[model samples]
Target: MSSRASAPTPPPSSPDTGALPMVQPAPSGSSPQGLALGLSAYVIWGLVLPLYVTALAPAGAVEIVVVRIGFSLLFCLVLLAVLRRLGELREALRTPSRWGATALASGLIAVNWLLYALSVVSGNVLQASLGYFMNPLVNVLLGVLLLGERLRRAQWAAVTLAAVAVLGMTVALGAVPWLSLGLAFSFGLYGLVKKRLPTPGHPVTGMTAETLVLTPVFVVGTVLLHGAGQLTTLTEGAGHFWLMAASGVLTAGPLILFSAAARHLSLTTLGLMQYVAPLGQFLVAVLVLGEHMAPARWAGFALIWASLALFTLDQARQARLRRRARRALTGSQAHA
Candidate 1:
């Protein structure tokens, strides 16, 4: 999942969505502590996660996803109890509308996790990286389509460039990049649903509610897998079992770090840092995994990178303009 920032008060950062709640503006400057936390989180998400997924060898993607959800719920419950915030989880469950929304978000994130796990296990980490790289643009497009948000000229141009890049890849590969698109759209929609939540509970509480909503289904599925002798957790040896169990901490730890980072860094800094995960994935795919990138594929990635450049430049420019306006207003008031 990617860490994203929004206008005004950011939402609480979720494990999957990573958006800070929109209750207050983030700090305008970056602190060393925030940078360290943000970098650690992104690195783990980008570099460590694929390796971790690969390490879960004999286990299939479905089984891995099931275990991840089960363990993640346990982790969230422990976190809530320690923080004395179990009441928040209960309140969310008590409200029908909140529960329903959490359920929908739960489903979306489950799909995202399954897809990501499948990609990593199948050695398609490059495509997974591309999907995340495209995610911010996807968010922008979704905002325009679903939220009636307007895109500035540069943003429109950047989106058009991304579209062309996708078209080029499709033509070169002789098929759609379904894995890439699937990851992008699934997580994008997950973020959208979280944004539309009725109350926007604390990230940990929200995660608990989401996992609680899905726990029964996953538990039943786990039992069925074990009945068929497909479950690998116990049979995979103590090492693998422990690794599988560690999924919960891996899932929630980075998110908490990211949420803390958001409190100390500006959105612009966070926006730039968000790319660290995808870039790490890309490096891992090429350098570590030795995935061959054909000339056409390289060209496509170049175009996408160029599009991101335009998008980032435009955002920085807009932020500068806003800051200047604010400064001018302050100066005029002081003179009066």
Candidate 2:
């Protein structure tokens, strides 16, 4: 449902927002609650997010992002209060090391949100969907280069094919799809930074900290725009004003559900579930938005999907082996 940015194949400690920390297998008696949570979260992210952004007609991307950050902070604070996690937030603020990390993450996530909102408003939802589809693989590459993680041969092939797909699309479009690249790399990097941070505490608290760092920018931008009469929410109507104000809940709600779902689902199931968002996005772009999908773009999507299939299969295989090994160890210990 979310990336907050996806973790590498093992399903990061969390889906993207918080560190779920304990990823179980799909077969541990799947819960209806998990399924519902995962589906709801993804649907909101995939279907609702685009529609929401598109509905904010004539609002510039910067304006929307600014509003989103401000509201998201408010939403997180409220949730933290309800959850009694304000202490966690205070702890994060007290730590200087976390400030820099959260700041970088805030910047990356801001860029991701800005580009995503822009893509939807501009009817470039296809590019946005493709960018997210490309993100996990991008994380793979980041892991290899930045985290010194080794990838299996299949993983390498997947990464290479992803590059080829992007190259093919660029050749076909006759220009680099900067929007897609911008979304992919920025979110990928955000996940990378979040992975390095201390995860023993609440994830929403971490997100709240990042948004706190970003609040000043939004505050200033809001003031400047309002002073210049460029902020249009007041003129828009009560409904529009409420929608803008609801940005925080929209941002954090799915994430909270996702973290709950993580408690019930396996890494494999959650991994598969994550696809719902982009697929929803892709469908919305084609069916509702009526965005053009040329033959080359289709071909590019085909390549990316094929690469993802290979990558997913490889991860599944590795997970199976790991499970078997643990089972064997347990059996031997029993004999002893």
Best by lDDT: 1
lDDT of 2 by residue, 98-155 (tens): 7777788788888888889889888899998898888878888887788777777788
Taking the tens digit of each residue's C-alpha lDDT, what string does model 1 give over 1-336? 112332221222222332223333274988999899889888988899888898999999999889988998999899999999988877877878887887888888888888889888999998889888888788888887887667777888888998998999999989788888898888888877877776354777777777888898689979999999999998979999999999999988887777778778898888888788888899999999999898878988998999989988888887887899999999999999
Candidate 2: lDDT of 33?
A: 90
Residue 122's lDDT within candidate 1 is 91
What clash count goes with each model? 10, 1
Task: Give per-model TM-scores.
Answer: 0.93, 0.92
Clashes of 1: 10
